[model samples]
Target: MSEAVDWGLALATGVRTASSGPEMSMTEAAAEVAALREAAAAVVEPVAGITALSAPEAPPAVVVDRAEWIRSNAGALRTVLTPLTDGERQVGGFAQPVSSRLAGLQLGLALGWLSGKVLGQYEALPAESDGPQRLLLVAPNIVQAATVMGVDEHDFRLWVCMHEETHRVQFGAHPWLSEYFAGEVAALVRGLDVGPAELAARLASGIRNADSGGVAGWLQSPQMRSRMSGLMALMSLLEGHADWVMDQSEEVVPSAARLRVAFEQRRRGGGLFDAVLRRLLGLDAKLAQYREGAAFTRAVIDQVGLSGFNKVWSGPATLPLAGEINDSTAWVARVRSM
Candidate 1:
C-alpha cells in the first residue's frame, strides 16, 4: 500500500522552517555540547536518588542543533505513526502522493515550530528494537533560552539536564513503559482512519472545543478518547515528576532558585501571537501538564513521602487517571489501595 506521509518531505520541510538561533562559533558550540554531556552524566545518580528509581548504565547524551533535533523527532514521529501511514488504511479522497505530501507538510510545519521551543528530550526506544535509546540535549535552544532568561548558562544547562535525566530514569527504571507508550500511540493513530468528511467534522468540533482541553479536545475522536486520556495522564506523570525533581537541584546548582523564577516567568510571558500559536499547538495544555502534574506530585510527596509517591511507577494501573491528575487525594487513595 502507498504510504500516507512522505517522511523525507517532512524532515526537509521541518529543517527548513526551523531557523537557527543564538549564533555560536564552532568552538563555543562544541564546548556547550561537551558541558551538556557531562551535566547529563552527572545528574543520573542524583535523579535516581531523588526519585528512588534505578536506571541502567546509559549512553552519554547526544547534543544537537535545531535542525538535528527536528530530524531526530521526525524519525521518531514516523516510527510512532507507522500504523496509520504505512498500512492498508489511508486518508480518503486525496491521491496517495498528494495525501502523503500534505500530511508531511503539516507535520513538518508543526515540528519546525516546536524545534525552537524544546530544550532537551528523552526519546524512549522500543523494547524489542535494537537501536539504543537516546537522550537529546538541544544545545542552541538551551543557550538561547538561558540567554533570554538572563541566568547563568552553566547552571541552566545542568538544570535542564536534571529534568531530562529524570525522564531517562523514569523509563529506564520501568522498561515496560516504552512499549506501553508505543502501543497506545499506535492504537490512537489506527483510530484516525476516517474519511475526509469525518476528519473535517472532527476538526471543526476540535476547534470549537479547543479551549476546554487544548490538544486533547481538539484531536480526540470517539475511538481515540480513552487512548488519548491514558497517554495524557502518563505524560503528566512523567513531566510533572521531572519538574518536581528538578526543583530540588538548589543544592548542586547554586542558581537553581533564580533559574526557576526566570524560567517560570518566561513560560508565562508571551505576546498575543505567541499565545494563539501555543493554544493551536496544544502547548497551552503542555504548560498545564507541568503545573497540574507538579502540583499533584508535590501534594502526594507531601502526604506520603517520596517512597509512596514512587508507587506511580509500579505499573500502568498505578498511573493517575485523567480526573485523578487534578485530584491528588483521589490518586493517592487509589494507588495506596492498589
Candidate 2:
C-alpha cells in the first residue's frame, strides 16, 4: 500500500464485529442517548461553572458504536500523523519502508484494542462547515464497562455523560482551547526528528526492553520530554476538571465511589499485551493524570472555592505546569499571585 493508504478505515472496518452489541435496539439506544444528553446538559453549567457559548450552540452529543469512534478519531489521527509520514528525515534507507509500515500497523492495533476500552471521547474540532464540535459516547463500550463494573446501567451511563459533557462545556466556554490544543499537538509533531533507521530500531528494541518502561525510557530526549510535559499538563487539567465537574451533579451517582475503585483496579489489571500498549503509548503516565490531577483540582477548589478556581480558565498561563500538577499548593500560589 502507498503511504497515503486509508489504514484507519481498513483497520476499523476489518474488526467491526469484535465489539459487543449494546443491550438495547438501535432506536431505543438513540432515544436513551438523547434523554441522557439532556440530563447531562442540565448539569453542565451548574457543575462546571463554565458556561456554554449559547444555549443552542452547545456541543452536540452523539451515541456511536466502537467502529464509528475509531473512524472519527482516525480522521484526526491521520491529519496529525501526516507530518511524520512525510517527514524530512524519512529519506530512503534499508529499513524505511518497514518503519513506515510498522508505524501504521502499530497505530491500527492500538486503536482496535482501545475501541473496546474507551467509553467516551470529546473531539474538540474547529467548528466544522456544517456544525459545532461533537461529544461522542461509545455505546457498546459504555454498556460493557457498566457490566464489567457491575454498576446500574442507568447510573453508569449518566455518570459517563456528565464527565463527557463537562469536557464539552470546557471547550464551548473557551473556544480558543480547540486551537490551542491543536497548536500544541502540531508543535510537538513538528519537533520530531525521528529518522527511518531510528524508528525501525526503536520498534525492534521495544519488546526486548519492555521491562524498563519500553519506548518511554528509550525516547526520553530533552525535546520529547518538554513536549510530553506540556501535553501531560494539558491533559491532566482537562481530565481532572472533567472528573471534578462530573462529581458535582445535582443527584449523585451512589455507585460512583465503587466505579472509581473498579476503574483504578482496571488500570492496574491489564495483561502483557495491554501493558506493552500502555508503555508504547505512554498511557502509563495517564494513571497519574487521574490521581495527581484530581488531587490538585480538589485541593485548589477546597482552598479557593469554585469561583476562585475558575481562574484556571482565565488563561492558558494559569494552567498548572507539569511539576505543579502534583503540587496543588504551588499551582494555587502561582494562580493567586497572578
Candidate 3:
C-alpha cells in the first residue's frame, strides 16, 4: 500500500493555485491581505456619535486554546469518521478519491482569492498593497500539521482537528456556498462608492477616532453593519451545522462534550477578541444556526424519520433554505393535515 501523504500542504497549495494558470506569477496576481486590511480599516473608520456593538462577547475558548486542542483529538476523530474514508483512512467526498479533497479546499480559498481579484480588476484597492491571492488558515488548525504533534497534547489538538475537519468536509460537500459567498463579496466590493474626497475625509475622521478605539468607529456605519450581519448569518449556517454534526457523534468521541461546551462559550460570548474581529472576521458561534439546522433536520426526521433526513444529504437540493431552518411547525402541520 502507498504511504499516507500529508494532506495539509497539498490542500493549501491546491487552493492557492486553483485559479492561477500553469505559469501564473505572484507578480502577476495582486495580494489580498493588504486589500482586506484596507477594507477592514475602511469599514471601521469613525463617524460622529456612532457606538460599536457592545464589543461582541469573548469568543469561545476555541480561539484562545485551539492550537493545543486539535493535537489531542486527532486519532479519535480519524477513527470515528473512518467509515467515510477509503481503506487508507483518507476521507473524501462520497465515492470520490482522496485527492478530490483538495478540490474542496479550493472552494474555501476561492472566496478569499476573490478579494484580490476584485481589487485588481476594479480600481478599488489601496496603493502599495501586497497580499497572497488565497485564504490563510492559521497553522494550528491545518490537518497534517496537527496530526504530527505529540499525543500528550491530544485534548486541545483533537478539538481543533474535528472543527477543521468539519470545515473541510462541508466545503467538499457544498461547493455552492463557496460560489455564493464569493459572488456576494465581489458584488459588494464592486458597489463601493467612496470618491477620493470622501475617502480622505473619512480616513481623516477615522484617524481622529483611532485614538478612541482603534478601528471600531468605522464599523458603525449602517451599510457596514448590514453587510457584517449578513456574512455572520452565513457563517453561522455553515459552522452551526458542523457543530451539530459533531454533537450528534459525541458518543463516539470521548471528549465531545468538553469541546462542544468550549466552542459554545466562544460564540455565545460573541466570538473572539476585538469587536471588529468578531464582526469583520465573520466568525459566529453558530449556536443559532446549529439549532435551526438541527431542528430542520429533526423535523424531517420526525416526518420521514432518520432515513428521510439522510436522503437530504443525497444532494444539495434537499437541504433546507434559510426560512425552513426553524419552520418545523410547518412540516408537522403538513404531515398532520395529510
Candidate 4:
C-alpha cells in the first residue's frame, strides 16, 4: 500500500503556505527567543507549586518560526498516523501517489492556516524514538498576538508560558499520559478504515451534531464515539487545568487580569470568514474546552479544595466524563465513590 500521507509533500506545502508574522531582524528574533526561554523556565516552579505536580527537568524550550511549527506538527502527525499507514490496521486504498498527495495537501492547508494562530504547544511526542519531550514556543505568533492584544509583551509571553508549561508538567508528572493519548489517537485512526458508505454516514451525523460538538462532533464516527468522548474529556481537563493555573499565577504576571480580558476578547474576535474557518478546524470546539474545562476545575476546587481536586491526576479512571465536565458535581461524586 502507498503511504497514507505524503508527509514530505505535506511539509513542503505547509511551509510554503504558512504565514510568517511580523518580520524581525536576526537580532530581534534571537532576543525574543531568549526572552521566551526565560519565561518558560520561570514558570516551572510556580506551575508545580500551584498544581502540586512535579515535572521532571527536561530540555530547554524550542522557539520556532511559523514554518518550523508547521514542520514539527507535520512530523508529529506522521508519527501519529503511522499505525494507519504501516501497521496491521493499515487503511485500504490510496495506494496511488495521487491519493496520498491529495490527503497531504488537505492536511498541509489546515496546518499552514493554524501555524499563525497557535501561541505555544507542548510536544509529547519526541522527534526521534527515545528523544526527550519538547515544549515548543512560537516566537512570531507570540509577538504578533501580544501586539494585537495591546498587552505587555513580557507579561503575555510569561502568561502563554504558564499555560504551555502546565501541559509539559501534565505529561511529565503522569508517565502514562502520553502513551494513553497516543493509543487513543491510534485507535481512532484505525477506526477510519470503514467503507465509503459508512464514512459518509458518519460525516453526515457529525455535521448534524456540529451545533453541539463543533468540528470534533462532525469528525466522530460511531465506532469511535466512546474513545472520542474520553479523549475530548481528557483534552478539556488539560486545557482547563492549564488556564486555571495561568489565572492563579497573577502574582507572577501582574498584568494577568488585563491579559486575560484581552485574550478572551481575542478568542472571540475575528470576522465571519474567520469564524467559519475556526468552526471547520474545530477551534471553536477547542475554545469551548477551555471554558468548560476551566469551569469544571473551578467547581471541583471550590467543592473539595485543591488537594481533593488533585485526585484527577491519579489515572484515566479518575478523569471526568464528557457529561461530567459540565456537571462537576457528578464528577466529584463519582470520584469520591472511587
Tell me the whole-model lDDT of each prediction, alpha carbons only.
0.71, 0.61, 0.34, 0.74
Off by over 4 Å in 1: 86-88, 125-130, 193-223, 268-286
Give one digit per residue, the lDDT tens place, for model 2 in 1-338.
24533454335542553356657877977776776666566555554443222233564577777777666655665555455556454455423455555655555555555667677777764223234567787777777777777778777777787777777777777767777777776665556555433432343344224333344443447877676576668777777777765565435566766666676666431212222333444554345665666777889889887777667777678878888888888888988787
Q: Which candidate is the best by lDDT?
A: 4
By lDDT, the better pick of 2 and 4 is 4
Best by TM-score: 4
Evaluate candidate 1 by giving its C-alpha RMSD to the native, one decimal: 4.6
Task: Report the error of model 1 at residue 139, Å.
Answer: 0.5
CA error at residue 170 for candidate 4, angstroms: 0.8
Error of 2 at 244 (Å): 1.6
TM-score of 3: 0.38
Q: What is the overall TM-score of model 1 with all chains considered together?
A: 0.86
At residue 193, give the lDDT of candidate 2. Answer: 57
**Model 3 ranges off by over 4 Å:** 1-153, 191-233, 267-321, 329-338
> Clashing residue pairs in candidate 4, if any?
none
Candidate 4, position 139, lDDT: 90
Ranked by TM-score, the better of candidates 3 and 4 is 4
List the candidate numbers ranked by lDDT, top first.
Answer: 4, 1, 2, 3
Q: Per-residue lDDT for 1-338 in model 3, tens only?
A: 22122224323433454343223245422332233233222222121001111122111122211222222222211221223233423323232434334333332232222211211111011111231112122322222222333222334344443443444444434445444544444433323342222222232232223232222233546666556445444444444444555565433345666655654443322111111123223332223454565456556666866554444333334444444556755544544443
